[model samples]
Target: MDASLEIRPAAAADAEAVAALLTDFNGEPVDGPTAARRLAALQGIETVLLALRDGAAVGLCSLRVVPFLSADHPYAEVTELYVAPEHRRQGIARRLMREAEALARAQGAPSVYLLTGFQNETAQAFYRSIGYGDYALAMRRRLI
Candidate 1:
C-alpha cells in the first residue's frame, strides 16, 4: 500500500470527487449531484470503498454481495474500479481490490466476480493478474 494512502468506506461527502473520478476513468462527464445521490443510497445499503491519499480522494471501487441464483454461494460483484491517472501503476488499484476482497469475505461472500468489455485488454490483464477467472458471459442491451 502507498504510505500516504488510506482505504476506507466511502461517505456522502466524497461524492463529487468520486463522481469526477468515475467520469475521468469512464471518459465522460457525470452529474455530480446525481452521482452523489446514488452513492448515498449505495452507502446506506452496500459497501463502496474509497482510496484517499493525503486526505484527497483519488480512487474508488464498488463491491456488492450478489447471490448466485442457481448456486449456494453468494458472490461479490466488483462493479467499478478506478484510480486517478496520476496514481496509476502505483498499486492503488491493487490495494483497492484487496480491500474489496476483504470486504466481500466479511459480508460472507464465497467468491468475487467482475466483468470488463471484451476489448478492454488492459483491464482484463489486471483482473487476471489479480487472480480473477473468466467463468461467466456478460451480455448487454443498448437502450440508447
Candidate 2:
C-alpha cells in the first residue's frame, strides 16, 4: 500500500469527488446534486469505499450486504469498482477489494459477489488474479 493512500467509507461530503471519479470511469457526466442526494439516501443501506491518494480521489468501490433466509450468512455485492486511468495497476483496486471483503467480514457476510461485462477481458483477468471465479452468468430484464 502506498503510504499516502487511504481507503475509507464515503460520506455525503464526498459526493462531488465520488461523482467526479464516476464520471471519469463511466465517460458520462453525473450531476453532483443528484449524486449527493442519492448517496445520502443510500446511507446505511450501502457502502461506498473511496480510495484517496494524497487527499485526491483516485478510485472507488460500491458494495452492499444483503440477507437471504436461504443462507447461513449475508452476501456482499460489489456493484462498481473503478480506478482512474492514470491510477490503474497501482494496486488501488486490490486495496479497495480487500477493504470490501473486510466490510463483508464485519457485516457477517461469507462471500462477496460482483458483475462485470462478459466482454471485458481485462476486468475478467483482474478478478481471476484476485481469486474470483466465473461461477454464473448474470442476466437482467429491464422493466422500464
TM-score of each: 0.90, 0.96
**Candidate 2 structure quality by residue, lDDT tens digits, 70-98:** 89888789999999999999999999999
For all candidates, the clash counts are 0, 0
Q: Over 4 Å off in model 1, which ranges?
A: none
lDDT minimum window of 10 residues, candidate 1: 39-48
- Could you tell me which residue pairs clash in candidate 2? none
Evaluate model 1: give its TM-score. Answer: 0.90
Mark the regions of model 2 whose C-alpha exceeds 4 Å error after superposition: none
Best by TM-score: 2
The collision pairs in model 1 are none
